[model samples]
Target: MSSRLINEYLREDKLPHIWCPGCSHGITMRAIVKAIDNLNIEKNNICIVSGIGCSSRAPGYMDFNTLHTTHGRALAFATGIKMANPKLKVIVITGDGDCAAIGGNHLIHAARRNIDITTIVFNNNIYGMTGGQYSPTTPQGERGTTAPFGNIDKNFNLCNLVKAAGATYTGRSTAYHVNMITKLVEEGIKNKGFSFIETLSICPTYYGRKNKKGNVVDMMNYLKNNSINVKAAEKLSDEQLKDKIIVGELYKTQEPEYTEEYKKIIESFQKER
Candidate 1:
């Protein structure tokens, strides 16, 4: 299945991905492809967009209409692509820093508009591509090259942020739970409005070494032990949930999608004319 997916969806020439050994970005990326395949969406009907970051490299390797845009601007570019052709399934592959830090505004506005786009955030906690800088999602008190003394800012709960901002569908999953990532992404793609799926990727090279998160195995173990499915969490006490990663579909609802609404206005004007 992996080989078939590689040949069908991935650019074989880019066989060697640049992510460090044990990095979870690869797992997250493959899950995305699996979701697309599960949907059986035509290769020509998909448009994958990305910004500058380790995770953004996915679009280049994916066999689709891909756009490699500037840092933090993938969503802006994706918005245009989605507006121009609502028939196309637009997917934005972005990292924590690329999506939540520099591209924060775009994230919120896109969600607010309820655009028909599936945004998958490969949140590895720290900036992996542009050095080991602390990202917006970096847990408070975690160490990074930019926060050698320990990060002081409160990390953003990205799932909560997007849900609050009006994303019709939202989910959170980790690289350890590869199947869940694929499931959430598949559901996100099926949604008619903005959809956000945050995949907690592991940056073992920088984030791990700097924060003393142990080796890749240890990091994977952490995800396995610390994550609680949202359904299971409902039965756990607040104390039991402390410091636990909530994983699963967080929110879902129906709303008027942006491009469709715009089309309705254009039709109304044409009728009046």
Candidate 2:
């Protein structure tokens, strides 16, 4: 099944992705492909956009209408594509820094507008491509190249941020939870308004070595042991949930999608004319 999906949806010429050995971006990428396949969406109708970062490299390898935009601007470019052709299924593949740091405004505004775009954030906690810099999602007290001692900033809860910013759908999953990532992404795609899915990936080369997170298997094990599904978390106490990663859909609701509302205004003007 994996080989068949790769043959059908991936650019074989780009074989052997550049992510470090044990990095989980590839797993998250595969989940995206599987979600698209499950929906049976035509390749031609999908537009995958990305900004500068490790995760952004995914669009280049994906067999679809892909846009490799400037750093922190994937959401801006995606917004244009969505506005120009509302019928297209626009998906943005971005990293934690690319999306939440430099592209933070775009993220919030896009959500505020409730645009019909699925944004999948491959958050590896650190700035993997640019260097081992601490990212917006990097846990406080974690070590990074920029923070040799420890990071003092409070990390952002991305799912909560997006949901509060007006995203109609929001969810969180990790590379260890591959099936859940696919399921959240699939559901996000099916939603009519802005959708955000944060996939916690592993940056073994940088994040692991800096913070002593162990190897790929160890990181995966940590994710498995520390994460609690939102539904299951309901029964757990605050102490049981401390430092625990919340997985599964965090929020979902219907809203006026930007493109659809824009189309309605155009139609109204045409009728008046």
Ten residues in sequence with the least summed lDDT for candidate 2:
1-10
Candidate 1 RMSD to the real structure: 1.1
lDDT digits (tens) for residues 1-273 of candidate 1 = 359988899998887898899998989999999999999999999999999999999998899999999999999999999998999999999999999999999999999999999999999998898889999989999999989999999999999999999999999999999999999999999999999999999999999999999999999999999999999999999998989999999999999999999999999999998
Model 2 residue runs over 4 Å out of place are none
Q: What is the C-alpha RMSD of each candidate to the true structure, in Å?
A: 1.1, 1.1
Error of 2 at 127 (Å): 0.2
Question: What's the TM for model 1?
Answer: 0.98
Per-residue lDDT, model 2, residue 92, is 99
| Local lDDT at 102 for model 2 | 96
lDDT of 2 by residue, 1-273 (tens): 349999999998888888899999999999999999999999999999999999999998999999999999999999999999989999999999999999999999999999999999999999999789999999999999999999999999998898999999999999999999999999999999999999999999999999998888999999999999999999999998999999999999999999989999999999998
